[model samples]
Target chain A: MNAAEIYKLSRLAIFWLSVTFGAVWVACWGVGVFIPSLITGKMPFLLQVDNPSTTVVFIADLLRSLTPILSLLVFIPINAMFMVLFERRSLALFTVRMGPNRHGFDGLAQTAADAVKLLFKEDITPRGADAFMFTLAPIIFFAPSIFGALPLLAAVTNNHDLFKVANLPTGIFYILAAASIPVVALVMAGWASNNKYSLVGGLRSAAQAISYEIPLVLSLVTMCLLAGTLDVVEIVEQQKGGILNWNILGGGALSGYDKLAPYWLNLVDTSFDTSAMFGQFYPVPWLSSIMAFVLVICTVLLFGLYLTGACAEINRIPFDLPEAESELVSGYNTEYSGIKFAIFFLAEFTNLFVVSSIATVMFLGGGDNPIPKWILDRLPLEPISNALGSLLSPLIKDLMFIDPATFWAAFWVIVKVYSIVFFAILVRGTLPRFRIDQLMDFGWKRLIPLALILFVVVVFARTWVVCHG
Target chain B: MEFVNVQELVSTGVAEALAFYFIAALAITLSIGVISDKNVIRAGFLLIGVFGGISGLFFLLQAQFIALAQVMIYAVGITLVVVIALMLTNPRLQNEEAEEEAIASSEPALLKFLDSIRNGFPGLVAWIAFVTVYMAIRSEHWEQSTQTIGEDNIAVIGRALTTDYSLPFEFASVLLLAALIGAIMLAKAEKVEDTDTPREGIESGSN
Candidate 1:
């Protein structure tokens, strides 16, 4: 083939490959809806007798497995774009002014427009800079965010697994390790920029990241200790009893009681029936229950610190001194513009969502159905009672018959995560940037020591309970 | 290295060829860049590429965790630290005349000896090590060992690290603590010196 013809052919090949990949992704979503049971074996409580054809089952399973990933692939860019718009609007609102109201449905398409502008913008290479590393930094930063999602979201089952591309037993650790990679890219970007401010920002980021990373990891380790597995699906399963079973509710010990008084105060009275806290199979040891309570409290505290640390690590507001626009001129990203800058922006939002999702799964009882059994039992299902039940029952029951409880639970998880994200955005809108020294001190003096002490308490409690029991 | 069937042999051969091509390309490209790049930062980044390619070869040899750890700690962490240091020092913007004078003063014989070692020794050792290790690995009865260890179990690794390698892990923690303390002291000393010099100058001027 002639050179021009060969170039055209190569271009066509690339186009077709991308198109085929996109088609497969959409097809997976369609198959996932109809034959999800085939992918995930069976619904949690449902039973099946005869098996489908192995070939058909395998194809369905594969498609179903790819669905969540495909959805995520589509979701990330859209989410990033919308979040940018959201942040702009929120900031405008906070400052009492309209912002970016022109372009694409009153700034609805602002992010997309910005993205296009960035794509066509000039790519600048600073003098004396390493051109290759400068170009490579953003790609490295973005790639890990995508790959990190793989292990975090992947689920597996015996016959079928739901929504996961691959299951790693060390899934939690993989997420931690993978997420840590973007820090390297940030440092690279700073160095490659050949700017003093960028270098300082990068140094500050590294120190801040390494500091917070300890507590973030310790919090996850605490969850692992409680669940006895690092697998995400298993962790969710342990929270099947809904909000009551959530680790934050102290394992349902105070489910029926008025939560006005502290748990320890209630425990001191000994008048209350603590039978509900004990397992049906075995009597709960008093010491173990107390230890478990202590561990849960420590976990919650560490989780709070972790969430704050994550916001800081991502260079979000209040702790966003590294990226303070006024001070450091966009901090480590000072020299970055166009698509390189967009990638960094995308990584930030993606990391935010990831942190929130993890918090949801660990503390908030992920994907658990929310309805209490007592409330369900109280509702009259008989003809005379059916009329009354219609009035008494929640509106959620009318929309879908597939147990509104689980739906509400999942909805709550989404709400909780979004709220955390919203709070992060609000902080960005409201709070002033911290000085770099203050940021470092907050990490080292406050967060690390607190995390370490909490970790020790958790370990000691778990060991004591185990030995006694 | 007995293959049970022709298909198996063909698949193995294809995989091996692909691996060889990538590894060889990476090694040549990175080594050339390392020597040619005038910028110290770029050279450090190139060294990361060399480490990464070696790690990929390790993965092909069925050391998946080790390969990942190598990439994580050395290629990402250590190399990033080096790049950061380079940026902090601002080597590229340093006085060119001073640099030229320093280079001119160095003995030609010593420089030539260092140059020869850098260019020649690593390449020779890499070639010898690759051929010997590849032959040894290819000729081994890997399937027999697979039967003994079972399939793709990471439990053994987890147990080994926590039990057999616990002492090393503890020692590593101590080493990190010491490093942290040392860094703090160095930083503090520099700050103290800066403050003391200013104070002493003010007092002498007042007197």
Candidate 2:
């Protein structure tokens, strides 16, 4: 609406974002750098190449595994808290109502208060529920979100060695496999609750997930094929240098275009045969150019297909049929209370964040400046860069508290991820829930076929031209 | 600080052995629970654990792709469908039907004998399979390969599948396509009014 209200929302977002980022940075530094060095001499894990004691090596190796969980443990709740508040406020803005403003200044502290209340609330197991599975359900649901996102750490952090332990050779496949796991938890929660609505919700979720996972998996698989690598870091690395090199922008179709860009941008007059160079890049001339154009369109559609499938997979509106209140009375987790409910709530948001991060890494250029390097190099950004570098120098060098690349990587990732998150929330506000039959029909008939066609098109089209990885 | 050779500490070490035993124990326990548990759905859920433990063993063996595939396919996809099918079908009705058939026909002496123990027929079959595999393992001369399967094993596998194993891969895909087509044929509905005999019903208009 008005400029003043917009200003207030921006300010609110800044406050919560800083709180999350600041806390996360401190925790990562502590686990990844400080505490380990404090315990086993003042050498960093980065010095593993240097001959170190078994204790030092052991602690370093151990902390590498711990780093993902530790960061996630710190990140999830705060991020979820911010997301919930942001969602409520944004949704309220859309619906023309005040949302949770009574708790704290303009509702900045509302989700924090809600989170505390949830933590202290009574944990209830419904009568006739499977007690063991009922208790284990939330944990099963929540655990995968942490481990599933570990590979992304390397991708997001630009393949920093500290997070290298999280990088698997199978990469996105591992994450997809992990993503498949949470449905079982939902089913368990549904069955253990011994509620009719819960069971229906659970079965619907299984059917939906099974249907939608095809397109989601295929879309990502198509990207992997185009990129020529399954490794997340390699995929991200290939999309580096500029927005044109990014997977979304014709994938590596622009790579040939990319080489000739800097010369034009810098206003260089080449004595060499530019036409011949162009011919060299595109051997078949018109046919190759057309194939490149086709690949670009296919990739864009595949990305949309991914978002649609991912929306259903995570049970977000209009695909959130499993938890539709009208039909299933809050669905599978309806019977859960207190911390368990909080956990399911937290994991759902974290899943959203993880999905966005995957989108950021695979589709969007993770941490790469949208402006090409030559342009960015020529901009009047040196002073600001130097000033920030100086400010972070102590943390970067003396204490090894920050890696500069990781810092900027983290920054760009945040910007890209949160934009996607905001878009998802906007979508939630806009769409109506799909009927169960309609949902399945759309997933299987529309999205899967479209995804398959796009995948096959990409498979053939990529061979005629160079691709990112 | 005390130091140990990194290779000595990890490869063929106590940790690996311990992990192997732990996963094996978990798998055995879950497999037993899959059969012995009275509640069939619960047993189905335990089957997930059995598959997961085996995947964990695969992880230890450094076959990450296979391990993840195991979880993705068998543990979640096949098992969940199996459990759902079991839930939808009436076991009591099946048992009654089977007993009736046994009574109606000339029941095999071995079938009656095997019915005495709990899950006797399947258990005996499983034991025989396990013994055959064990005997095969014993007879074979096993050697550790000098080469290490590095992180880029996926690329190597991909290359081999397309180059050397392409024909077999194509054959497997053809087999799957046949199965898929057969399933669709079985499930497809017909125009009820056109058909005779089995199609004679009140619902003549139903597809």
TM-score of chain B of each: 0.61, 0.75
* Per-residue error (Å), model 2, residue B99: 10
- Candidate 2 on A1-469: residue-level lDDT in tens? 6666567667878899999989988988888888766656645445654556787667665765577778888999999999999988878777777767777887789999999999999999998999999988899899999999999999998888778877888999999999999998888898889998988888889889999999999999999988888899988889888888889877788777777776656545656566677776667879888888898898889889888888888999989988999989999998999999999999999999999999999899888878877677778998998999899898788899879888888899999999998889889999999988899889889998898899889888877787775
Candidate 1's clash total is 4
lDDT of each: 0.66, 0.86
Each model's DockQ score = 0.17, 0.46
Residue-wise C-alpha lDDT for candidate 1, range A1-469, written one tens digit per residue: 2454334333433343344335434444356554654344553235454554455455555565566567567767766766676667666666766667678545555667887888898878789776888899898888777777665553212112344445556567667767777888777788889887887777778767766677677767666766667766667666655455665554333332322233435434566545543332123556665765675577668668778877876777787766777878888889887778888888888888788777777666666556544444445646765675576465425322223333345456556666677778778887777887787788888888887787678667755332111
**How far is B30's C-alpha from truth in model 2 (Å)?**
0.4
Steric clash pairs (candidate 2):
none
Question: In terms of TM-score, how similar is model 1 to the real structure?
Answer: 0.72
Q: Candidate 2 — which residues are off by over 4 angstroms?
A: A40-57, B1-12, B91-120, B189-207
